[model samples]
Target: MKNEELRIKKSGFWLLASGFWLLASGFWLLASGFYILASGFWLLASGFWLLPPTFILHYPLLIIHC
Candidate 1:
């Protein structure tokens, strides 16, 4: 009887730990996804102005080497 009770308690502890772990991981993933989505929208909104400096001219790389 005592061994059975100990086994139940151990199992309960692991179940609770796993539940919290899953919730935390889910929340972290959700928040990270939201951030990336927002960043993508912001870049898209400013893409015309942002594009030349970021990719077109490569001016920064040239300046760095010079």
Candidate 2:
């Protein structure tokens, strides 16, 4: 009877550990996903900032060539 109780306790401990691991991993994934999304927005903003210099440099060159 004691052995049976010991097995039940062991299984319960493993179940709790696995549950905690899954929760931790899920939170980590969510945090990384948010970080990636934020970086993507930053990249888009940087691209916008870069556009005017490109237009200024190219348009006159095209007109001069033509």
Candidate 3:
């Protein structure tokens, strides 16, 4: 029972961390997209690095938000 509780706690922590990372990535991607549009190479590079996770997170929201 104690082990089960520990596992649950760990799982919750991971979930929270994952959510934070996803949000951070989304912000980074948004910033990157703006930079790329403005033709800033460093921003474009940063955006490219951020793109995959942003794309993953953004797709679902696009359908829902729009």
Candidate 4:
């Protein structure tokens, strides 16, 4: 009974540890996902902001060609 109790306690400890790590990894993934999404939006916004300057610089070329 002593050995069985010890084994059960060890199993419980492992279960708790695994659960903690699982929760930690879940939060890490969520944070990274949010970061990726935010960076995607930032890149999209920056692309739009660059368009006007690009168009202005190339406006004469476009008009001459047209």
Candidate 5:
């Protein structure tokens, strides 16, 4: 249970962090008009670093509000 909780937290953190990165990259791409490089960063920030361990580790990713 403890390990599961930890994994969940880590996944959530990564999800949020990557989401922010994705948003920032998108904004930068628009502001600077840099499509190619910014698109690469956007793709990576969207899922490349956020999806693998979150799903492959068998931890169900969920959002709960308190």
Candidate 6:
């Protein structure tokens, strides 16, 4: 039905948004990891502080597998 189609569309939009957010967060983590690895203790400490909350926020979205 039309309502069902609308619901599906809405869900699709949400999925796409979630995917974008996850990708962004992943890139952030990767860049942070590399900075941590390449640089000395200060960069490593900063990267550690910054990356975890991003990972934690996106962990459930990553599990979505969509």
Over 29-55, each residue of candidate 3 has an lDDT whose tens digit, in order, gives 999899778778777778778879878
RMSD of each candidate relative to the true structure: 5.6, 5.8, 17.2, 5.7, 25.8, 19.2
TM-scores, each model vs. reference: 0.67, 0.75, 0.57, 0.76, 0.49, 0.55
Which candidate, 3 or 4, has the higher lDDT? 4
Off by over 4 Å in 6: 41-66
Give model 2's clash tally: 0
Off by over 4 Å in 1: 48-66
lDDT (Cα atoms) of all candidates against the true structure: 0.89, 0.94, 0.90, 0.95, 0.80, 0.89
Ranking by lDDT: 4, 2, 3, 6, 1, 5
lDDT of 2 by residue, 1-66 (tens): 999999999999999999999999999999999999999999988987878887867978999999
C-alpha displacement of 32 in model 1, angstroms?
0.9
The top-ranked prediction according to TM-score is: 4
The candidate, 1 or 6, that scores higher on lDDT is: 6
Clashing pairs in 1: none
**Clash pairs, model 4 backbone:** none
Clashing pairs in 5: none
Candidate 3 yields a Cα-based lDDT of: 0.90
